[model samples]
Target: MITLVRTNDIVLISLIEALLREARVPLFVADAHVSAVEGSIGAFPRRVMVPEDHAAQARRLLRDAGLGAELAPSPGGS
Candidate 1:
C-alpha cells in the first residue's frame, strides 16, 4: 500500500475514507490503534493509504476533491 495522507484531523480522515469508499478504492487507516492508545495526542498521526495499483486513481480523486495540499509527498520527493 502507498500512503496518500497523514493527519491528526479525524474529520479529514473521515472525508477521505468516504471518498475512497464511494469510489470503491481500497482504504487503510494506519496508526489508528496507536492514536487510540495514545489518547489522540497530536503525535503519531493516522495515515490514509490505498493499494499501490489504485494509488494514482486515489490521488487524482483526492486532488479533485480539494485535498491536494493534504497529500503526502510522493516517494523520492517527486
Candidate 2:
C-alpha cells in the first residue's frame, strides 16, 4: 500500500474517505485507533493508504478535489 494523506483533521479524513468511496477507490485508514487512544487531541495523525497500483489515481482524485496539499509527497519527489 502507498500512503496518500496523513492528517489530524477527522473531518477532512471523513471527507476524503467519502470521496474515495464514491469513486470506488479502496482505502485503509492507518492509526485511526491510535488517534482515538490519543484522545483525539489532533496528535497521532491518521494515514489514508491505497494499493500501490492505485496510488497515482488516488492522488489525482484527491488533487482534483482540491486536496492536493494534503497529499504525502511521492517517493520520487513529485
Question: What's the residue-level lDDT of 16 in candidate 1?
Answer: 100
lDDT of 1 by residue, 1-78 (tens): 989999989999999999999999999999998887888568889999998899889999999999999999877575
TM-score of each: 0.93, 0.93
C-alpha-based local distance difference test score of model 1: 0.92
Clashes of each: 0, 0
TM-score of 1: 0.93
| lDDT tens per residue, model 2, 1-78 | 988999988899999999999989999999999899989578699999998888888899999999999999986789
Candidate 1 clashes between residue pairs 3 or more apart in a chain or in different chains: none
Worst 10 residues of 1 by lDDT: 35-44
